[model samples]
Target: MNETRREYIKRINIVLDFIENNLDTKLSLEYLSKKAHYSAYHFHRVFLTLVNESLNEYVNRKRIERIAAILLVKPNSSLKNLAYKYGFNSDNSFSRAFKKYYGISPTKFKSEGKELLSKIGIEPFSSEKYICSIDNIKQWTKMNAQITIKELPELKLASISNIGNFEKAGSMFQKLMEWGHQKRVLDTSNFKAITIYRDNPNITQTSKVRFSACVTISENINTDGEINQHNLKKGIYSIGHFEIKAEEISKAWKSMSIWVIENGYEFRDGDYFEMYHNDHKTHPEQKFIIDICIPLQKTENIKLGEINNLDLSKYKDNLDYHQLISYMKELRLFFQKEYDTIFKLGKIYQGAPNFSYFSLTTDELKKQKLKFVIILNHKELYFSICLSGQNKSIRKKYWKIFKGSDWNKYHLAESIDNSLSIIDQTILKNPDFNNKRNLTERIEKESLKFINDIKNILE
Candidate 1:
């Protein structure tokens, strides 16, 4: 891509984002040209060349499709309100435009939109209909996937934005991998190829829906022309790990969506993506191994985003988190088997993809309503332990005591109102995992020291 083309794509991307987000408002060539810093006529030509559609044509299609989506969800929803809300002048005008796209009037579309959508080769995801047939979805998911709720860590990514033509993604990923190898910033220990959906295909016109092909980066690399750099938000998600044929990808996503709704989880507005594992081309039956991740609202009592206690940057590394998780499981078993009499160890909690931990409490500490947590933060590639109470009130009481005291032996919480730990200590950083036994011995020494020191303080 040349400099002029790059600038054109970048500017057009901004305008597209704005137009998609604000379709209910007046969008004129002059107003949109201002957004692109181009003259109205020049912007018109640029949009036509890049998008292969006139600005008005693109806008009108989007509005009509959005109305189509609404009708699918609410067959009785007022077409006049929806059509006018999306910038149509009147009922007759909206009908003409809607018919141009769907080949049927808006009123007819409200009744037969699903069939119309299927004819256009677009799969519809209707929330209203999905709710009615959730039991089958649940059964399908149970037979095909192992689903769980997880908190994914913030990830640094280099991505290429693509519109509609998803078949081109394979080539896009190839280009990205080549670029990553050239930069020497690929996390080779743990490789991740992600496809992020920027627009809901069910609501937006399939040809206009945007998706991005992304790869994980070990450093904060600068964006190159069409490739951009950004971070995936850290949040709660409903993750479904599946190994399915290429054709079943859409079914996997829809099933996951229905499962999230059926489980009482409110969807959070964020990235809905697929983290691909194996290339379908290499599979015997051409199957893609993937994890479908859907962002979700935090459960009550677990205050997400309220506490920024984890100094995430302090432990950033190129370590493969999945590999680190395997190590964590091994280490947990070592403690359980070797010190069974000395420690009552809890199972490793993997609710989050970026970190995992197990609880450790002695008989004496159990009476005190306290335990210690050994956490492996794969984002930082380090291990740390914290003192936590059995409940929120207990943790709060201990946190206040530490906050008031002059004990600087470890990192204390600034506030406990939303934090999980009272005080924490970093026991190890960037472990040399090649020699597993040596690494385990080192961790054992440091962890025991932190535990004894904290115990002495309390006693």
Candidate 2:
């Protein structure tokens, strides 16, 4: 994270702490500024920069949100009493703010209280709603840090597109599944299904929204022009993963985006991709897993060099056979070189502080046949090549023990080297790479060259 973002998070936590403790008191800009350790004059702008909402707006919204919660469990609670408890002098003011935030007045919300109670803290609650105490807030915050922002290249997809709201997403996905089954296009063995949203829910009309139920297929799949094909453009993105009911997906998106802006990254305009690995169709509601990807574009004038440099050596020990192949591909693409033959064997895993794992195969070495293993997460990549039958036998002996276990299968050998080269090219292509004008600029230049060299050698 950048310095400005760090300051923003610090201030936000201070504000949240103060609000949680003093909900009944009048929250003023000057008072909150002191709590956040910022001058009153600059606090509003800073708060808006981090939260994407005005201070008064946030305070009022949060206040109403608290009132909404109180009405749920204590259904007999009086609106007037709740209003006063939340610092509203009269019910009228509280009702207006509540309606503005939730599209319903306090009394109406109480009458139809079930829906209002279901949605709290940007996520919707299910029939099994349970109030989360403050003690669990820190755990939630820690999980928030695991979210990451990434830039993904445009994907070519064959999908069944639908124009509707979130409410109809289930039906749309069902239709796509049926179509895939009939066409024999979806491979159940490789079940990485995704939904692409072309319109932003925050701005688009419910009926006019566009969504696509998609599945990744091999490039060789022939398109007869019957299936809808889309090119998702390459761009920076903010990504997060959550295991929750489908109804609560929106909450994850809101939280992830809020964190992104708080950390000084600007959200870019593009289709958001939600890859669903498990859902009610195959898994229980509580165990449903989904990965959300939001496109992001950096707004602040920050240089890549200023960011903390990633320690590459940490991954040396954990290098997997497949990752090693990817490294080789990077070197080939960037350096324009090729090895006569390569063999790898190892088990690699992701380690703490961005460390990764790799374990080598213990087999008699041969000039012709090579063996290696690359482990990444639950997946491992193993490769072997032999010029003679005896050499192949040696490779087979080590490969037998590694084949039966469950692992994420992938074809990483073809363009492994080229991929790393592209990243290096992107950094060096920046204008600041050559100008040693300042610390940030010099850092960008050196970082770009280093990345480029790494890519060149991997090939």
Best by lDDT: 1
lDDT of each: 0.79, 0.51
Model 1 — which ten-residue stretch has the worst lDDT? 302-311
In candidate 2, position 131 carries an lDDT of 20
Runs off by more than 4 Å, candidate 2: 1-141, 165-168, 181-191, 205-208, 220-226, 298-459
lDDT of 1 by residue, 152-239 (tens): 8999888888788998998989999999998898878767999999777776666778888999998897757667775788999878
Top-scoring candidate (TM-score): 1
Model 2 per-residue lDDT tens digits across residues 1-459: 476665566566457546645778989999999987889878888878755678887677667756765565355788888788888887778888888877778788777756553453232322223325332332342333235455566565566555465666676567657766777766566566788875444333345345677775534354332245455678766666555665556656655655554566655646678887665555412445677887766655433322111233443345433344444333223322222232232323221112233322223333423323221221222222111112334434433422333421322222222121111111212222122245234333443344334323322
TM-score per prediction, in order, is 0.58, 0.36
Mark the 10 consecutive residues where model 2 has the least summed lDDT: 418-427
